[model samples]
Target chain A: MKTYSIVLLLCLLTPYLGNAQENFIFKKAYDLKVLGRVSEDTSHFQRIDSADLQNLPPAVQRYAKFSAGMNVVFKTDSKSIKIHWKLKKMNTLWNMPSVAVNGIDLYGWNGQEWQYISSGRPNSEDNQMIMVENLDGKMRNYRIFLPIYAEVKDLEIGVLEKTTLSPPDTALVPSSKIAIYGSSITQGIAASRPGMAYPSILSRRLDFDFINLGFSGSGKMELPIADLLAKIPAQLYILDCVPNTLPEQVKDRAYPLITRLRMLKPEIPIIMVESVKREISNWNSAMYTRVNGQNDEYRKTFDKLVAEGYQNIYYISTSELMGDDHEATVDGTHLTDLGFMRISKTIERYIKDSIAPLQ
Target chain B: MKTYSIVLLLCLLTPYLGNAQENFIFKKAYDLKVLGRVSEDTSHFQRIDSADLQNLPPAVQRYAKFSAGMNVVFKTDSKSIKIHWKLKKMNTLWNMPSVAVNGIDLYGWNGQEWQYISSGRPNSEDNQMIMVENLDGKMRNYRIFLPIYAEVKDLEIGVLEKTTLSPPDTALVPSSKIAIYGSSITQGIAASRPGMAYPSILSRRLDFDFINLGFSGSGKMELPIADLLAKIPAQLYILDCVPNTLPEQVKDRAYPLITRLRMLKPEIPIIMVESVKREISNWNSAMYTRVNGQNDEYRKTFDKLVAEGYQNIYYISTSELMGDDHEATVDGTHLTDLGFMRISKTIERYIKDSIAPLQ
Candidate 1:
């Protein structure tokens, strides 16, 4: 009977093991948490308020204002893990809140119930670190319940699987970042959801980091803002502020902005983008005129840069990017989700073929 | 003295004729007129309320509340122009009003003062046309205004000068249009201004008619939407809905959606976009796992389509698109305007090299 039981257990484990092998082993899982606090004190929660859930999707809406303290679950399969978290405190005027994690809530669950483990707030600057020997081999799920005062703007949950057991010495290093300075369209005004934004979409596709400085109507390529941009560390800098500016502004700002960014990070790739064609009557006659003027200015800048021996700068024409399709835009000025995808793919290829080679 | 005066007049005329050769012509202009009615009648104005303007940059905030009796002006020169105009009525609903030339505030300087020639609505669909003669010869600034019930969203003005005039029939035609579909990032959410969006930037560079269809969070690859897409005529269709869908959803819908669109337009180009990398703790481990699974399924579908002898289907990998920059995202998920510009430029090159050949 014992032998038969052992064989049966092995038989059952075969499928599970096969699935484990087939599962693409992502980076070793880590205990990732985010903590924040409201800038000020607030009343206790009684029940999940519908109004609080307004912005969330239906799946997570009901849990918006949990009164009895809700348990947040995260799944992972690693014996050791690292935690990266952020703690923010909001003020009265600014509703943004910070979340916190207590030592009691960090627990290791044996199959039946969650077993309390150790926890503490991480150093503010060194928010990420590794853990060892705390996890069991069983599918581990990390759960945390908040004090109902904090709001989580961004959170990440990952598991450390052991196909690769050793963690890198420098784990959780910041990913390479691409920075775009542009107008309203970059701000994600019309996209259906936050995650669906093209930048978000591109991030997922390319496995990199991004910074969106898309001020809705504020991408004027002014010197002040360009000064701010010069402070950032980026692998690529994209300058596309011509749509909102008049031709004179385009002529005035385009070259200087490009030159400024290049001056700051001489080797970093700089791409100057012109505006897309708007859906207006007499599509060809009028649209091309403005486009050409902008491009001419850009070209002149590019030529100057080239003459000055700058080699890393590039220019992307609008016609090829938009492909003369009128339906891609929701309004004449903004792109629909479809338009973003098309442009993202085109960008993806360019980065791979052109930029990636340099990297 | 009389002979000297005649010579002076002739000399002035000679310079005027020479100046005509160097002016920029306003090839075609489209005037978008808004008729004001009671705030209750929202149908007349494509109403965009204050809330809609909430996300827009300061420049466009005033124009967010588009009510009836608001006149919006859009114009194009031989190079670039504004194509689409969306407005909000006083009641807080967004509306798209028909644009006409007659309603434009046309003014001509009668030697002493700038007099209003006409302020009546023009028949846009019928006899809607504005032609400027000898505009390039003299440096003249033309302004178009749209008065919204609340405030103005955008005002576009173009300068026309005298130049070699090409007959209207000789005007250049838009070679093709690239239709992009995706999410909020594609829609230019959170960007400082409208024109800064990557699509707009890319459009300005390439000089193609751009149709932006980026809904905030609604790019789910649903058949109902696909049905609507099938009706439109386009040279290229870029499918970028992955950011808005889960891996299972992508597997289930991607192939079908591509196939459906292909069925409608057999020869049109269709490009499938993968999602961008998210700055999750695991660096897109889980999302990538899901994306790869979906991509595999999509590739298989593409193979099947090819086997069935379908052409013009392409895939753009995300890795090549974003380069090594991961910090370009504002959050881990969404991109800053800087990121959009980089992505747009990258895509612009890809489309130019790949699709331009076919075109």
Candidate 2:
């Protein structure tokens, strides 16, 4: 009985004992929050207000709560950095989430573009933290990409003891808050790491602070969502929710969402994206119909908006967004890392030409 | 004492009393093994004989045991299909082990191309059998792609009770046993799933049986590996080991390996490949130097081989293999799905034109 008790005690105390390095506290990201970290709440996890959240239907509210692309930027002088976070909930089995789903990717701004640094993994007890060691100590600029698919309940960052940590020049990041509302692909699936997601890639490449309003399977452009989105101050609004809605739903909701955005931020660039065509659609005419019809709605809506004297509204057709080759998708729908890169590259030109900076 | 005994008993019994559909037994893969199923061997997990294995050095021998594209072919009539496999060891921390290091993907041959079905995740315990349910009821074909970067101790298939599972048309698969030997990219690192790997994609695209001898960091073209690879009766031998080897290593091993291959199979085609260049190489000139120098070695070896009257030897330059764009890789180094697709398309033409079919 004594032996058994001793074994159980050791098992219980093992995790708490930790490594030689004392775990430091994760400071509040006050600067990044002001720059526009788009979690539902002020912290890292809520989508909308808990009171306002209840008014929506159960499914939409649940989907909205997912913390996709909600990241905080901070600088640390330590050679070792660690990520600490817990899921709102975990799906242990089924679907087999991609590597980037719950992982965090770190990128350093090398004066020009964001270069890859390292990835952090969860500890043995997954909810604890994953640590990365041996970062270059030259006080380089850094970005910690958030989870793509999962809902992060809390996120904290820690560096080695006595290391100086400071906030980066917010000017180094894009001055504009770029709000992109879309579906699963936009939420960033099949990317090997979070930084590889199109939006995340664009954030690094184009130097934009971003709001990923990508709701997997449920990002049909609802009026309530549009109303809520209008409250946030954005320099550019990207509507890419075509893939999740039916042709009829797109016809009804697509224009209203843009109208709402135009009402609040009339001069900002609002780019309406045609659903990226699926690989199977080339052979399957039914799939072709769905893809073509959805894009047709985008063209019609853009024309209607333009006729009404909405000058800043723009449109992107799917002609070459994913490239001519049919190898861009993972499951014929979601973008892989390659697909994400193509999307980022294709979108960069339009963004540069149309946004506030260019205008 | 009684309470302790009861608690222990429950721990053992809980997994068995799992969700209603009891995890069925994995059907034995009678094929894919020349030496009996090594999982049961109580030795290291190897698909080939230990006596022949001693010819290679220790490091390569350990890598050779990983079952990358090694699959067992079978047809089934059940409405559901399940996969059961155990890893020799498990990593229970971050990066989650779902995308690259260890994961399984199922592909079905739909007469023309290989279609993606589903991916399997382990049960609560990482080592337990992974089950995939709800497959088509018709007599269909399947290729269960094994882990790309991990060792598979055991693997088996499971169908619903009393369902018919028979051998597929051997001709429906590629008649030419294509032996491709390369590095981690060939082993499908970051492909989201196993079937999306270049070798696996090409197999489905061309309807060919394949042997993927891609070792992550161990693919140095050693004489022992060439001696062993010559033993297999391959229609075409793809030597893509350049990515892992340096220019000096290539200069030393390139001609000798091809010479060994030419001596064994005089008429068969042998395609030598330049390593797909990294994304960072465009700006980072040092990277450019490495990639350029490596391809130069490939050109040199191919020239030397052809001059010696080794006729069926061919070479693919880096220009078209990974595409001109820098967005094809997951990391700067590893190819993503887009990269894989581009590679397959580029190689397909070479395979058909260089091999007897196009001629």
Report, in order, each candidate's fnat: 0.00, 0.13
B184-248, model 2: which lDDT tens digit per residue? 77777656665677887787767566777776665778887776677667788888988767667
lDDT of 2 by residue, A279-302 (tens): 544433334554577678878888
Provide per-model DockQ scores.
0.02, 0.11
Q: Highest lDDT: which candidate?
A: 2
What's the residue-level lDDT of B196 in candidate 1?
40
All candidates: interface RMSD: 18.4, 13.9
Give the candidate number with the greatest DockQ: 2
The alpha-carbon lDDT assigned to residue A193 of candidate 1 equals 26
Question: Across residues A1-359, which tens digit of lDDT does each residue of candidate 1 receive?
Answer: 56643432332111111112222333312223211111102232212234333433343333223211222335565654444333243211000011111111234334444333322233332233332233345445554333222232322333454433322222222246666666545544333223234554454455344455454444667765555556555677767665555556667877677777777777888777666654432232333354456556766767787898887777777775554534344334555444566667766676565467576
Off by over 4 Å in 1: A1-359, B1-175, B284-288, B291-296
